[model samples]
Structure formats: structure tokens, C-alpha cells
Target: SIRLPTPISKPDRSYRVDVYDRPQLAAFMDAVKDKYDNVDQYHKLAYLRLLAFTGIRNGEARALTWSDMHLDRDEPFIDVNKTMSDNTGHGVVINPPKTKAGSRKVMIDAETANILKRWRAIQGQALMRRGLPSNVVWTNQRLSGRISSNQPREWLLAAIRGTDVPQINVHGLRHTY
Candidate 1:
């Protein structure tokens, strides 16, 4: 029997992303939550957390609806059946997940579930006041896919501004999960 040294785990050369350590993650998230919440941007925090905690894609998070969340269950999950597409020639559109395998359950931790639950109530009220249907989680259907693709990265920068927490894009945050 031959014994070998433990192998390194980092991705060698693929399109790998750097991950945030626990404290860095917490600090960045705290800053994002504080800045957004101060301006009443509840959905942004929820969206960010879902990406970080569940690895859900931006399009999928944008396309989420109250109907797609099962937050009351013993094990809460998001039903990722649809995604938002912004690059379509016609305009932003909702379509099926990128692949058959994309349509699956994404279980979430309690903290994320609570954030979503509170956001749902807030979103419902907001949509009602605006005379829009409370359908999507992140935004109304018309603006779902229209949000600038760079918004998440911008949010990350804003949160990390004046802080030592290293900057990372939202997609990379998903990889951290």
C-alpha cells in the first residue's frame, strides 16, 4: 500500500473564482444589507442573499414569484422553473430554465427564508400601492429582466467601498455558496 500527500483543492486553470472567507462574507453582506435597507431596498438584500446562500443565478432570482417559494415547509426551497432573459431581440422575457436539469429545487437556510418572507410582504404591499400585480420576487414582471446586468456588481462595489473586504462579483458570490 502506497501513501500519498493530501492534494490541493484549488481549481488549477479553469475559470475559477476566488471565495470570501466567513468574516469577509459577513462584513460584505452586512454592509450591503445596511446600505440597501437604509434606502428601503429590501429586495436587493434578499436577492443578494439568495445568490450567496443558495447559488441561484441572477436570472432565476429575478424571475422568482411568490408562487414559486415554499418557505413554510420544514425544509424551505425555491422552485427554479423559469428564468429572465434580457438579451432577446424582442426585449426582456421570461423563459424556461436554461436546461432540463436547471428546473429543480434549491433549498434555502432559515435566514434566507425569513428574508424572503419579509420581502414578500413588503413587495406585495409595494406592488399594490403602484397598481401592479404582486408576481415577481425581485421586481414586477415588466422590469424583471430589464434591470441592468451590472447592478449586482455595482452593489458589491458599493458595499465593499471604504472597507477592507475584498471585492467579488455577485456571480462569484454564488460560487462561494
Candidate 2:
């Protein structure tokens, strides 16, 4: 019988927690909002705001549809019951939550809800112009499909290019929240 060698354990294993402090978060949010003021940039603002405020996974946010949002309710909330998995051998696919807790409804603040409302209106107009139905909350500008998973990261990098705030990935925004 052959004996396998024991796995080696490192004594010093420290994980870096990348998150923005309160003031830094405020600065980042302000920078994101101010960096893009054009009519076409509304979706980006809405996406960033949702990530910063909701603490939901980036994939979950990408999976959000107009049907999952309840902005008109007395208590506005988002149903984070699904996620988009791009790792499938075939391509991007939508799937239900792996855990029961993952399918929870996250209540959002009025400000965030209002931002979404404005985005919906802008998106509705854009869809109407193209004779498309109002479905996804965020979609590719050039393409009619949903925005790619890398879009939020690209947007974050662009927004924080010259800012003093430490650079973090899109998931870090959720950690910040």
C-alpha cells in the first residue's frame, strides 16, 4: 500500500478584507454619480447604487428583471431569488438560488427605490424607441440582451480612475454595504 504525504499547512494565512469605510464609500458613490451625467448613463448609476446599498451578489443583481422589483409597493423591495451563472459550458444561464436563504426578498431604502424608478423610466423610453418590451432592468447599450457580468467591474474601474478612494471590485461594493 502506498501512503500519501500529509498536506502542508501554512502558519501565516491572512486574508485581506477589501471594503470601503463610510467616508470612502460616500466619496465613491458621489464619484460614480458625478462621473456620468448623460442620459444614457442612468442604468450604470442604478446598478452601482443597488450594489452599494443592497449587499447582494453581483450575479444576483445581473439576474434581476423588472418583475423582481417592487418599487411601487408601500415597502419597496427586490426579490433576490435567482442568479445568473456564466460558468456553464454552454454560456450564461439563469438558475434558482442554491439555498433557501439565497431566495430572500431584500427591502431597499426609499432613495435607492427612487433611483431605480428613474432608471426604469429611462429604460422604458429606450425600449420604446427600439420597439422592445420593458423586461430587464439593466441591458447592454449596444446589444439588446442583458448586460455582461464584467460590466459592473468595468464601470467601477472607470468611475474610480482618478478618485482617492481605494480601488475595489464590484463584489467589494457589497462588502462595503
Candidate 3:
């Protein structure tokens, strides 16, 4: 008979914990801006800015949509409600966050807000050029209604190649947050 190792009592214990310093994250964002000049560049730099400022998880950042953003409302916050989890190597599925607080709203600073506005304009044009549906704020190359988080991860990785920025996983930005 095969013997199994004793199970950990707390299944939810976090296995890895990495803390990011502000200067390191700032340098990464600077590198991103210096390397590219397009919507992908804006998306990544702004995403890093949001992660550094908000301290949210990578999955939360990947799952973000325009519907979650309220720039002029009384709250003027981002609602982090849903997340996407990898379903093997094929794709991902949208899931509710772990807690109500995990689904809470995060306030945006002015600098980050301005970056987002520019990104939105560029994204809008890209979507229009792709012939995507008007109501869809995000889409994949196919002009699908919504883009899966995996696609962005892959794109960011490709974009970061040959750049000075460290080869950190796309989730590293979220970890910085």
C-alpha cells in the first residue's frame, strides 16, 4: 500500500509571500513607458500604477472592466467584484471574489485616473477598428465581447521581451499592489 504525507490542517495557508518596494515598482513602470508607445504600453503602465496604488491581487486587476469604474459618481471608486481563475492551460472562468471586502471598491488617484482616460480612448479606437460590438469595452483579437485574462498575460509577456524591465510574471504587478 502507498502511504501519503500528512495533510496540512489549514488548507488556506498562503504558500508564497513577496513584498514589493515602491522604488522597484516605480522603476518598472518607467521602463514600460520608455519601451513602448501604444495602447498595450498604456494598458501595462496604467495597470502597474493601479496595482501599486490599490494593492489588489493580479486576478482582480485582470478581471477589471469599464463597468467597475465610476469616475464621476459620489464614490468615484473601482468595484472589484469578480475574478478569473485558470482552468488548466485551456482558458479561465470568472468567479466571485473570496470575501465581501475582496469585492469592495478602491479609490483612484488623479494621476492613475488620467492615465486610464488616455488608455480608454486608445482602447475604444482599437475596438472600433476590430469591428467589435459598440457596448463591449474589452475584447480579444477576435473582437469577442470580453477578453480573457490569459490573453492579456500572454500579450504583456510578449511586449516586455527585449525591454529593461525584469521578466516578472504579469501577476507580479498585482503583487506589488
Q: Among these predicted structures, which one has the highest lDDT?
A: 2
Estimate, for each residue in 1-177, the C-alpha lDDT of model 2 and write its tens digit: 999999988764233238989998898888888886557887888899999999999989999999999999999999998999788577889899999899999999999999999998888888888888758777888538888888899998888888786788788888998
Order of models, best lDDT first: 2, 1, 3
Q: Write the per-residue lDDT of candidate 1 for residues 64-109, one digit (tens) a residue.
A: 7889999999999989999986775777788998789999999999
Q: Which ten residues in a row have the lowest lDDT in candidate 3?
A: 11-20
Report clash pairs, candidate 1: none
- Candidate with best TM-score: 2
**What is candidate 2's local distance difference test score?**
0.86
Q: Mind sharing the TM-score for model 2? A: 0.88
- Worst 10-residue stretch by lDDT in candidate 1? 140-149
Error of 3 at 42 (Å): 2.6
Higher-lDDT candidate among 1 and 2? 2
Question: Relative to the true structure, how large is the alpha-carbon lDDT of every model?
Answer: 0.77, 0.86, 0.65
